[model samples]
Structures are given as C-alpha cells and as structure tokens.
Target: MAEGEEVKNKQVLFRNYIDGFPKESDMYISTGNTIRLKLPQGSNGVLVKNLVLSCDPFMLFLMRKSDDSGLFGCYTPDSPITGYGVAKILDSGNPKFQKGDLVWGMPGITACAGFYVVSTPKKGETVFVSAASGGVGQLVGQLAKYFPEGIDIYFENVGGKMLNAAILNMRNHGRFSAFDYLVHYSQFYDILLPFIREGKIVYIEDVTEGLEKTPAALVGLFSGRNIGKQMIVVSRE
Candidate 1:
C-alpha cells in the first residue's frame, strides 16, 4: 500500500461500563473505521496494525463504571477497548520506531517492581506469590526460582477473607506498591528478549483468530476456557 493510502480499520468497541462478569454481548466489533497509512505532521505517534491482543484480568477493572485508580483509565463506550498488544508499525513520526517494525507495548516487570523492589525480598527467603499460574504471578514465581542461590516459594491465590486477613496483619507504615507508575516498554522488552532467546523464558498463548471473536475470547476468560495467556490474533500480515 502507498504511504498515504487508507485501509479498513476494524475494532472491538466496549459496549459500556459493565456489571458483574462480562459476557460476549458486552462488546461490539466495528468495521466502519479506516486508518491512513501515514503519520500526521509533527505527531509523535506510531500508526500500526494490531497483531496480538493480550487478555488479562486487569482489563476487567477498566471495564467498570466507577474506576478512580487513575492507573489505566476506563475504556470509553462505543470506542475501542484497550490492553497490551503487539503490532507492526505501518507509519511513524517517532524516530525511536520505524515502519515495518513489529513492536509491542506490553508486560511483566510487575513482580520485580512489586515484590522485589517495593516489598523486601532476600536470597533464601521463602516468598508467597498469589495467582501462581497467571501471567504476572507465574513470572514472579519463576523469577524467584531463577535466583542463583535458589529461593523457596509459597504459592497460592489468596482472596476474599484471606485478603482482608492479610491486610489486617500488615505492619504499621508498611510499604504499598504500584506497577506501571512509570512505563519504560523498551526496558521491559530488553529484559525479556534476552531471556526469551536463551530459553530462560517462554510465552504461552491461548489464541483466537480475528477481531470478531474477541468478545467471546474475553468472556471465556472468566470461565477459564483458555490455557496460558489468552490473546486474540487480529492479524498475522
């Protein structure tokens, strides 16, 4: 396609701020949009086509109507839903990125920032990580294992009364932690890519093809329908 050409831009629109668990009916696939294959003058944006869309539980928080987290803001109604994703840039106004570059704005420095950085962790210290099989927790646990001297893990998913109990036991002036406070995607990828190449890290994908199927894929996440990381394959071009 020419640099100034436009192509149909398909999207998954959030129906509205949701109630309870989400259903396939909560999102709508839009096909009426078009994207120009060129960058706007003086813009710092990179125009790209989505390739892989990650589906994680945190997305549900943004789907709620009363969010005040100010971390990841709410997904607007009648507009595209948001999450981490890999895309191939078709146009660029940012010198740090260029056309045809397959870039991803995404994941898992969470455990490092939360447990290792904010919370104190030491070599040989036994650690408890919740959601040990999910994305961040799994990596956290794995990273714990990678410590050269070895670290013991007490992995479990604690919630409800257990969560309250844990909170109640917190020491006064205990440190609280937050991730994504300052995002450096390049740093994240730099850390991950080496581990990936060395086989020290691996990714699990529960992939669904096409933009239209994204809703069902998201809804199925509640029921644990997919294995590994749930993602939608929007394009492989």
Candidate 2:
C-alpha cells in the first residue's frame, strides 16, 4: 500500500437459494466502497477494513430460507451479505484493538464477509485446524503457529495424494476415524474407499451426499466391517 491511496469497497450479494450443485448463477456481485470508517462514539464496536475471505460448503446451508435456526436467521433479503473475513481495524471502541491492528473472527457472512463488528479476543495456543490450506483454515493454522506452544500438530498438512498414500500403508485391522466434515463424497469414493479395502481398513461413514454412491464404493472396499450401518444426518435442516 502507498500513501494517499484511495480505499475501495465491495459487496457480495446472494443470487437466491440454490439446489443440488452450486454454480456462478447462484451468487451475485454488488459494487460499493463507502463503508463507514468509524463506529459511533460510546458504541462498543469496531469498524474493520477486510482482508481475506473464505468460501466453504457450509455457506450453502446458510443460503436456504427454510434452513434451521442454527443457520443464519438474521440475514434479511436485499442486504449486502457478510461472512468470514480477516480485517484491519479502521477504528475501535474496545481496549483490545486500535487503528491498523489485524484481526480475524466470524464475520457477519460467517467466514466470507468483507467487514465484521465483533469483540476482539486473543485466541490461545496449539490449535489444530482442518483444511489448513483453505482461507479460514489457513488463518487458524497460522494463528496456532503464532502461539507460545505454537501449532504442536501431529501432522502439519497433507495433500490428497499424500493422504491417500498414508491410508494405504496402514496395517491390516487398523482403524481410522475422521470427522464427518472432512471430505465430500466424490472425493471419498475416488480416494479413501480403495485404501480402506486394500489396507483392510475399518472405518465409518457419516457424510450424506455419498449415500447413493455408498453401496458401490463400499463393495469396492470388501474387507471393512459390513455391519452396524448407521446413516446419521448429524445436522441437516
């Protein structure tokens, strides 16, 4: 940044709730730059200049009006949207922040917004973030490494190919467990399923989108446990 450069504003708009897979038509873009540079005096809020933004599948859940209240219910029609964004303070009302300080949080848009008004807190140590390469993932990962204990992760980061190799090498009768949010169905079938059978791997499946494809992908992994079938929809509205 240079001295005396004019600041610009951007707004992201919702294109309407989408069905099945999302496409470019599912979102709209709005242009604007006159964001308030400060919060009103006596108000406990901070005005931020946003930095990085993230796009994640969880965002899809927020788009539907019929979604559960756990989703973003306060979002109104026609308002410029918000989400997770890293920002620098343009002004603040709390002692935790000052002008030009960098901060990160759950932006109004959940992890994709341009600016957010929220309390600034100092997050503590040794955080393990999933999808460390992604926008939000990367931020948390970097923040972890910044701490005193500092990102003492068992595994730093792994790509698809490397992860596949690791699973394939597991000993027979080995068990592997992962969170439901880890990967999408298309990816699991194409990558993890084969390794499960080849490594005689025992695991569980909780992801839903791959339900229809489960039988086939499982058949390919014949050695894994075939019973105790549970298809729990952990949080589907």
TM-score for each of the candidates? 0.74, 0.42
lDDT per residue (tens digit) for residues 1-237 in model 1: 788898888889998888888988889989898988888889999888788988877788788986483667888889898888898988888899988899865556665445544566556464545444444434543442444333343322435342333344444443444344355545655676787789997767788998899999998786667776788888888
Off by over 4 Å in 2: 1-8, 69-77, 105-237
Q: List the pairs of residues colliding in candidate 2.
A: 82-109, 83-109, 83-110, 83-111, 83-112, 83-113, 84-110, 84-111, 84-112
Cα-based lDDT at residue 199, candidate 2: 80
Q: Which candidate gets the maximum TM-score versus the true structure?
A: 1
lDDT of 2 by residue, 8-67 (tens): 555555656645544445445455555555577697887766554433334445555664
Cα lDDT, model 1, residue 10: 88
lDDT, model 2, position 139: 45
What clash count does candidate 1 reach? 0
Error of 2 at 72 (Å): 3.6
Candidate of highest lDDT: 1
